[model samples]
Target: MSARRPYTVRFRTPDNNTLENCFYATDAFQARLLAMEFNRYIKDHPNRIDKIFSAAQR
Candidate 1:
């Protein structure tokens, strides 16, 4: 596996609230990918999450 670094993931919830969590990734691309995966997970569950974004995206 590639070496990973700490990244912060910020996402909005279905309730219109925001949440953040730390994730590991080899690079920004991978980090966003991981965030998208997590976003999918949240979407699959009710009131879980609404959006997935990288703190560094902006």
Candidate 2:
């Protein structure tokens, strides 16, 4: 099994501001999913994810 690592998810807000968050997951796909799930619960309604990559790559 692979260990989870931190990934940085860059997303655009409704106001056109680009923001970033760090999520720990087994892979980039999982990190993106987690970001989307998090966006769902925010009062902003929807935030489009711009990119997702390993935090170490930054």
Candidate 3:
């Protein structure tokens, strides 16, 4: 029998220009942890708004 693989989830934006993110988790709890970390990143770096807008203009 083959070994079980860990669970993973990806969050993406509607526009294709921005960088995509992937979250890997061994289980549901880990998945939640990953999501929380991602959220914190967004909150801390609000300047990403400008980057996305500039990319769209190009």
User: lDDT winner among the candidates?
Assistant: 2
Q: What lDDT score goes with residue 2 in model 2?
A: 94
Candidate 1: clashing pairs of residues: none
Q: Which candidate comes out best when scored by TM-score?
A: 2
Model 3 clash pairs are none
TM-score for each predicted model, relative to the true structure: 0.52, 0.78, 0.31
TM-score winner between 2 and 3, please give it: 2
> After TM-score superposition, what is the CA distance of residue 43 in candidate 2 from its true location, in Å?
11
lDDT of each: 0.61, 0.78, 0.41
List candidate 2 stretches off by more than 4 Å. 41-47
Model 3 misplaced stretches (Cα beyond 4 Å): 1-22, 41-58
The residue-by-residue lDDT of candidate 1 on 1-58, one tens digit each, is 8777777766566666778666788775566666667667544552343333444653
Looking at candidate 2, the ten consecutive residues that score lowest on lDDT are 39-48
On the 0 to 100 scale, the lDDT of residue 34 in model 1 is 67
Estimate, for each residue in 1-58, the C-alpha lDDT of model 3 and write its tens digit: 4332343433334453454334444444454455557766444543342221111123
Estimate the lDDT of model 3.
0.41
Question: Who is ahead in lDDT, 1 or 2?
Answer: 2
Worst 10 residues of 1 by lDDT: 46-55
